[model samples]
Target: MPLAVYILGLGIFTQGTSEFMLSGLLPNIAHDLGVSIPDAGLLISAFAIGMVFGAPLLAVATLSWPRRTALVTLQAVFIAAHVAGALAPGYGLLFATRVISALAYAGFWGVAVATAVALVPANAKGKAVAIVASGLTLATIVGVPAGTVLSQFAGWRAAFWAVAALTLLSLICSVLAISAGHGATEEPRTIRAELRAMARPQLWLSYALTAFTFGAVIVTFSYMASLLTDVTNLSEGWVPGLLALFGVGGLLGMSIGGKAAETYPIRTLVLGTGVLVAASVLLAVLAENTAVTIVLVFVLGFAGYITNPILQARVFGIAPGAPTLVGATNTSAFNVGNTLAPALGGIAISAGFGYASIAWVGAALGTVALFGALWAGHLQYRTLRTSSVVAKGTAQEEDRATTHA
Candidate 1:
């Protein structure tokens, strides 16, 4: 809601664009680098690996640094990494730089949650965080497709250069928007404390929900090019358009998700995940019709994304003290899902299942996630209700003591 959030959103947008642009340009990169498409795809895998390792590590490592400095410094590193990638002479060098750039990726995500919590009031907290995180959805729609297009015209290297410039701009925004006192206090979450939070049943359940919900989506979506050409009969040129369409739905879903957070939390997750599962099934079955396929893809993107903010907010509420750790872990959790989905989806396809079968896998995952949300809702209700009663009892005792005196 604040100006600062918009600035933070810009950083997220740039990060999302820079991170995913390669998916659209995979074929081009393979050709240019004189490697196989699978080898070129390693750049994406390397980044995910970085996040899995980097997200929580950055959360823990930046415990002492001020939040503002940490964010600025991370963006700076991101800029450098992009530039390095843009100028990289070989695939090995570029892949290594991608890993190095990912160091800041986790740090930014870790700090971004902490920053949002500090920026907003208790009720608007979810929405605030959503605003920052929604940048990912936008990248799906605008940034990635735009980057992909830039790749088509200029070259894959040029896309990285564009991302480098975007990161540079994000650096300026981070420097200007965040308050000086933002990161003044050290993070209080000790490793043990963070582990204790993780040990909670609700926490692991949330992670499970995150992994499968996203994994099913990614596995199918990763091979989306095949689906469009094989099933929908789209030209290679149209893949970017379809991706852009999905991105649009994702962005709209996030904006609406922020609003939805105010009235209901867990209920929103139920609705969003349900839509995603149903839509995935429909898309898989009816993809033969081009117009229907387009609509289904849009809805799939919208429904799948709306749950993202809700889940992150759920994690933060579950572990209020360890925002950085929980937040970073969830980010990694989604990527873990992303990493697993492709291989799993490929196996299903290799086993003679059609593209639509991936949707069944996704549907099963969503069903499991729905149950997870129900469980989380129960934990959340009990925890809050118990705390409320204790506070009321404490207040009554204090009142009686003061009156007697």
Candidate 2:
């Protein structure tokens, strides 16, 4: 992989930490801003909403810009937003800053993914994506926890300041490392051309698969703490450690899937989603058994993440002509899942289905994703067969004309 790819990953690490660290700091934020915990939690939703809208829009707006320029500009915006957030005296301002930060983060992610794949060979695209995505998994293991600890010792504002400083470093590294001409589109694509590429059915299928696959795990993961405490009978202290364990599993999954997805995209998706469905079912059935639940949690993380690189890489394959827009829409699709699954899980809990039901919800989503993968494979097969037939017909016609000559 290119050095620029790793540098982009570093940028993603800082932004991802900011994205998730708010969860740990919500209580502190709520108390400081004189708001309810639920209200503070809306900050997270605000970020998601920003990501959902910002990615596609910013991607198109910057479609013709140099990749390095777009990335650096977005990082600068992100750093400024975080600084504003850290200094904001009231909740409304902080919320506005979160939205701004997320918009920057989402735009950065779309451009970064496009740039990473552009820097690598077609065969290595999945691995490149995995390398970039590893930053987020690492953030789950290291950054979020460290931010929580910092918030505990100093204050929540300190965490925001730290993220801003780190992001500033990333922005500097990005400026120094990435080449100006690398990953610039050979020809600037019109917005109409990009939108035209998105009209493919296979591309939409890929988007749906991406959503369901990620949503399957998030549905359970969003409420993992409650399940671990109220159902598994573990103390709160164990939650962080177990969450770290899940992150470890995700990292491992990324490593394995990255190497396999370029060669076996459909197979990787099938196997990964299948395991995810099984793990969700097992977690639901055996939630009362602490050991079983713990084991399945790791399995759930591993299974869910193993398909991530494939999902990211496959869209580029399906819509090679419109990588920027495809990348942005894929990012939006991911947030769609992120936003919906938890809400659905909350409804289930409100309906008295219990926390375990979220696992069942995950299982259902995974099943849909699993079937979608198979369907995608079928579509690829048919397309290949049709192309083969057309090629053979053209060869026969050429042979006939040569014989007559």
For this target, which candidate reaches the highest lDDT against the unseen true structure?
A: 2
In Å, residue 105's CA in model 2 sits off its true spot by 0.6
Whole-model Cα lDDT per candidate?
A: 0.80, 0.92
The residue-by-residue lDDT of candidate 2 on 73-110, one tens digit each, is 99999999999999999999999999999899999999
**True-structure RMSD, every candidate:** 2.8, 1.3
Off by more than 4 A, model 1: 181-198, 381-405
Weakest 10 consecutive residues of candidate 2 by summed lDDT: 180-189
Q: Residue pairs in steric clash, candidate 1?
A: 66-183, 67-183, 141-247
Q: How high a TM-score does candidate 1 get?
A: 0.91
* TM-score, per-candidate, Cα-based: 0.91, 0.97
Put down candidate 1 lDDT per residue, 1-405, tens digits, no spaces. 677777777888888787777888899889988999989888898988898788888888876677887888888889888888888888988998899888788778878877877677778877887798888777777888788778889998898888889888888877777776543355454767776766677777888888877775666678777889988888988887887788788777877787787678788887888888888778778888899888987887788778777777778777776777888898889888888777777777889988767777777777787777778788879989999999999999999999999
Residue clash pairs of candidate 2: none
